[model samples]
Target: MAEPTLEPSTEPTLEPSTAPAPEPMPPRPAVAEPTPSTAPEPTPPSTQRKAARRERLQVPHEPVTVHEATAAASVALAGIRERCTSAPKVIAVELDIEDGRGQVARLNFKPAAGFKAASWEKCVRGELESVKYPARAAPSHVVLRLQR
Candidate 1:
């Protein structure tokens, strides 16, 4: 038997590619600057109504008696005393009750130990504002000292 001789193959070897690169993206368009307007925007109707209401409510009118003021405040604030655990022991409130509505003018609190007067101010004001008061000769200016 004759021995067979080994021969190298003649196929081409693979190599890394050198193709042309993709074109760069076009520059983004520039944004236009906002132009300043000569006149301010008009106020909405709802906002205008609210401003009118506030003006009407805050207008100075004839004043009511201290007795009238006290009675109205007592009725309005009774529920708050029962509902609020953080309520002050004593509260001095000044209010203006006009046209079936009440607005808090000032509030002073003698809070219990560890209690804060500032914390309860908003609650008291809200309660006062929610009350309905009969139209009086004028607005009421009364200082009430409520005790627990």
Candidate 2:
């Protein structure tokens, strides 16, 4: 009347009912062997890597106003772009804000052969820094970016 007694079951229960052991695997067949030929292969001439040229954008060489040069790369970017709506492809230019000293500002573009990106960014930045940038800051830089 006071308590109920329960006895534990004595049973060896197995989980993951083990399957029958598989038969021994057969050995793989022999692979074909390669033999060296007596004839020697000829070497090709040396070549240089070249940059890809798509469209030639005609960037006007004019005196851009101080205000217009902040995002200075707009016209050249627009000219270089294949599509109207998308932004042009940009490569980084590590420009020295000061002469020779490496206080760099970020500039992104591709320049023509013999053109220097660092100097160009410096020039663009100098022009803008000399004047107060407009509240609606227009692009002051004028460098070409590769069209996507």
Candidate 3:
């Protein structure tokens, strides 16, 4: 059998190639093309909503004149007095209903010690006393308390 052999290495070789290089061009005179600036159109204003001039006052309501104020006061007082006189008996007072509608009125009555039914009965009586007008004023309906 024959053996193979190799020659020893020379120092690593790196060399530049001999070739022509390129040249840069000269700058040209600048042309004055107009700048692309744009101006926007102005927005038109909206119409004013000045309130329809309030009907010019023909009658002066200044100071609510004494005779006028007193007249209103007298009428209000008479109505209150009438409501006070027609109040119902306290055996059972209630919030009078009208066509199945009952208005809310707060109760000052409170629960007593050890008896729920008695407290409720007192509440019913107090409700009667608190009403401003008699149940006869509107007898079409009555209060219906529902527990849920």
Candidate 4:
């Protein structure tokens, strides 16, 4: 057998490629100034004063609680029972309350019950008008019916 001869290696060596890095961009501004058109214009003194006064006058308020309303109705009903000659009369009383104070706006009595006395309605109205409600932030309407 003949002996084999060794040959030189022809494969290339492995190495990392080198390249230039890109330049970084500049940072953007944090906030931009408001344009003249975007900004609100100043109003005249008189107009501003009027708007302030109107806003002040239009203060918000809350309605009276159910308990307070019931108390007021009870007081009115008791008064009605004492003065009303027509017992077992059904009547509806409507109250218009402003700033926690109430006044009778309407008094409706069932005509079929044969209770046509204006004095009874007037008396009930007087009693309801005197109802002092709890402090309320707004105006309220209350309707109470009297029966039994």
Q: What is the C-alpha lDDT profile of model 1 across 1-148, one tens digit per residue?
A: 8898856446655854355788999999997665567455889999999998887745345667667667766775676786654767887876667776777767773332333456666677777778766676565656677765
lDDT scores in order: 0.67, 0.38, 0.34, 0.66
Candidate 4 structure quality by residue, lDDT tens digits, 1-148: 9898866446654654344676898898788677898887899999999988887755346676555676767766777677766544886766667776787766673332343446565566666667676556677876767663
TM-score of each: 0.47, 0.19, 0.20, 0.46
Using alpha carbons, what is the TM-score of model 3? 0.20
| Stretch of 10 with least lDDT, candidate 2 | 95-104
**What shift in Å separates residue 54 of candidate 4 from its native position after superposition?**
21
Poorest stretch of ten by lDDT in candidate 4: 109-118
TM-score of 2: 0.19
| Top candidate, metric lDDT | 1
Worst 10 residues of 3 by lDDT: 139-148
Score candidate 4 by lDDT.
Answer: 0.66
Per-candidate Cα RMSD to the true structure, in Å, reads: 17.1, 17.9, 24.0, 14.4
Higher-TM-score candidate among 2 and 4? 4
Which candidate order results from sorting by lDDT in descending order? 1, 4, 2, 3
Q: Which structure among the candidates has the greatest TM-score?
A: 1
- How would you order the candidates by TM-score, starting with the best? 1, 4, 3, 2
The digit string of per-residue lDDT tens for model 2 on 29-79 reads: 997564467456545433222222224443444434433433543333433
